[model samples]
Target: MPGGRLTHRDRRDIGAGLAEGLGYAEIARRIGRPTSTISREVARNGGPGGYRADHAHLATRRRARRREAIPHRDPATPPDAYGRDPDAVRDFAEQLAALMVRTGVPRMAARVLARLITDDSGSLTAADLVQRLRVSPASVSLAVRYLEGLEVIRRVREPGHRRRRYVIDDDVWLRAWMTSAQQHAMWAETAQRGVDVLDPATPAGARLAHMSQFFATLSDDMSGGSGTVEDALTVLAALRHAGTSLPVAQVATALGWPPDRVTEALSRAGPDRLTPAQLGALQGRA
Candidate 1:
């Protein structure tokens, strides 16, 4: 009965409340839900910066369907309303899985990602994912490996577990963003080399030079707030390690670099591409 979750129809009113800049308590009173609930929904989804009931509702629905079809005995929520309905979560997961498949993600990888993204717990061991996904051990291993390389998911350690958990944190997008920009930067450098090789004054050289300039500039813009994309990359990275103090070594290792180099780079790189594995290796040397 947490008031935090809104119904579909209630989303419209939430929009009204938001437009008027009403406080959480006022919004909760208007919606007949708990203030904490509304507060959490906004905080978890996007803070005060960008929130839309419609989008949140849709995301909730998609999450629910991925878990299972809504059962007949489920309580009637206001059109977009959601309660602690187990079936709704299942339904959302089920639907999301289907959508991802249509978009060309392999079925197993899509299911694993869907579950990781939607779960309120926000962390799950590979065994948990495998059990929930109902895929083979090898499939889970492969999917998790691919996701880790893409920097779109992470491994979280839990006490009493022999194996680490796999999770999609709020920062998954940050890792992805930095990874991409670094990739583009590398491309730009390569293109510059192409220009030098082909003759700087020739048509081919000019084209390559432009390619290099375009990517290098694009990479720069990606880091700034006013840049084309809000560097969700840094914000997302910040969201992880929310409560705990991240060890300097841990941060460096997760980014793959020696401590001094990491220290230098954090000042300079500011969320650009860096390898996590190499950093971890360097930490062992420390």
Candidate 2:
């Protein structure tokens, strides 16, 4: 089995196999390589139907030359690498961005998020993003704003600096999830209101009522307010009411929840350390 990089001859064979209508696994087996290796090579180049061995080989050589030509100018830090493969991180970033796009994330925002997460510095100015992504500054600014609106990224001011940089942290996903649940609740409320205005016995009113129920159910599921989640929240509320940190055993005892349930509830509720008022706000009561 060939464990090293695919040779030009291998690519030609792959192209031939594709022309012969062979699946990726068949081609890989014939070439003595893993299916995934063959799959990535094919997908990265031009995909199954469009793949051309000569064109792929040339493109590969061009990318190799570009990497070699770019000098590593950061003396204080070594080149980014994953197990000595400097390009692995870049490849992963693009792959992640592509996956995000496929899963309904806006393309520009996905690209920007991927770049930010892969950056060694963990933050980037709009100008820095423009340069790195080779996109217009306006495009970067718009993508950044979209991410900020979703609560998936933050803008932080650098010390003694006038400009801000964008960053992502663990809290980002939590906030985004909460924001989505909040929106669901808002939709539920709007739909419920529509039912009343449209006459509850009519077809339109029935549709609106069903819509309201659907969103309400989704909101409850997302916010950990139903099923086992309801019990967990009750435990959380009790703990918060104590006004001081309590032991896991004590919390479990007070709420009649299992220790494991208490632990999970606290993990979801804490970290951000939501006060009673904040919790109320999440539920749209405040």
Candidate 3:
């Protein structure tokens, strides 16, 4: 049989001859392979002068494995070699943002989440977000505020700095549960009011009552009580302190309200909510 296939060792021996300036025909003859087979192998991997049998063989195997892992491709064949291109990272970020948008996450919120996921530190100062995302400071501000409301990320501040940062935590989903509980409470309250207004003993009232009961149970399961409340308060308080870093106009725009309303909400939430007015006020003390 014509030596149609070569093992890694065989390829290595053949490559060694070429490295020593032997002709392909001579090397192939020594390795008991066809001259054309040897020539094609070296050329396909790297030129003959740069070929390494082990490197080429591994590359071939890796491509085959990657292809096989794709499921649509043949198990025995390799795919293309992987590269450490920075463009790949950028593509990943864009793909992630697109995926999030598809999942009913608002565009701006999706952008912020995508950035947080891609960030090395799992957080970014507003300025960093503005710069990296190539959007205005207002966009980052608004996006971050919405994310906060959704209970996905918390805000943080650097020591002695006027700028605020946003962060996603290990317990993000746990806090999300509390957020769910709060929402459920609102819905339960609304449904309870409807039952009271329409007659609690009626079939319609009974259905709404059942709705209230369902949501209330889910809310209780999610809330896990005062401990979680305290934890959320701590994060929001830290964020309120950081909010001082935001400009008044930016804060107003982010909250989608007048500055006065912003001030009122901040004051009402009292050092507990991470509102801009509180941050601004806290900064004055420093």
Candidate 4:
């Protein structure tokens, strides 16, 4: 297999293959390269319809030269104030960014998110990001905007500060999770609306109804409300295991919860809310 950088001839062949309407895998097989290589080359230069061999080859050389001109950091350097090896931190950040890219994040946005997540303060101004990532201000701005839209990070201004900082906090994941659940709820609502508009017996309406139910269930699960049901079940399980009704205080002690929480769970686990098996497990607990 070809392992080194692609040559001009290789690019010409790629262009010819694209023009011939060949897929990336077949083109890669013919060129003795990986499909990923062929796909990335075409994507970075121009899409299949717009790709030109000469332009792509020249662009590759320019990019290579630019990368070569950047100064290399020595891994043997002393650690930072927090005793972190700078080179190691950079490699980890890049690895995290790559993983995010694989999970459908845009490349630049993933790089920005990874950098923010690894920072000691979990906050950075635009200038800090631009300097650390060695990218332009515009790139940083665009990446932050994308992340902000997803609720993964947020912007805040310190008192008396002119510039706003992008911050990732302990609750960042919670906020992102809620944002996703909210989106799912919107999808569920929209799907239900479609069901209402179409005949319920129609294939498309049935499909929409199923979609609505799926998204609604997923949203409810992801919204963190399912814990209530779990708590109720736990209360019932405690009573069932004892084979007798237990006071809220005793159940709380067994479950390591406050008595009032146990009482609330017990109150929610009434016959209306439980199945026959769950009601049997309840055993008349009050």
User: Which candidate tops lDDT?
Assistant: 4
C-alpha RMSD in Å of predicted model 1 compared with the true structure: 15.2
Q: lDDT per residue, candidate 2, 1-286, as tens digits? A: 4678889999999999999999999999999999878877875565665678999899788767765776755534445454434455656666667677667777679888998888777788988887676567888989998998887899999899999999988576787888999999999999999999998899999999999999998998888764445665787678679988799999888877678878877666663777887778878952
Q: Clashing residue pairs in candidate 2, if any?
A: none
Which lDDT values do the candidates have, in the order given?
0.69, 0.80, 0.72, 0.84
Backbone atom clashes (below 3 Å) for every candidate: 34, 0, 6, 0
Alpha-carbon runs more than 4 Å astray in model 1: 1-82, 94-105, 225-286
Tell me each candidate's TM-score. 0.47, 0.59, 0.44, 0.60
Sort by lDDT, best first.
Answer: 4, 2, 3, 1
Candidate 1 lands at a TM-score of 0.47
- What is the Å distance of residue 84 in model 1 from its true position? 3.8
Cα lDDT of model 1 by residue, 61-124, tens digit? 8767755753443465333344565645655675576566667766567677878888877778
Model 2, position 79: C-alpha lDDT score: 52
Q: Who is ahead in TM-score, 2 or 4?
A: 4
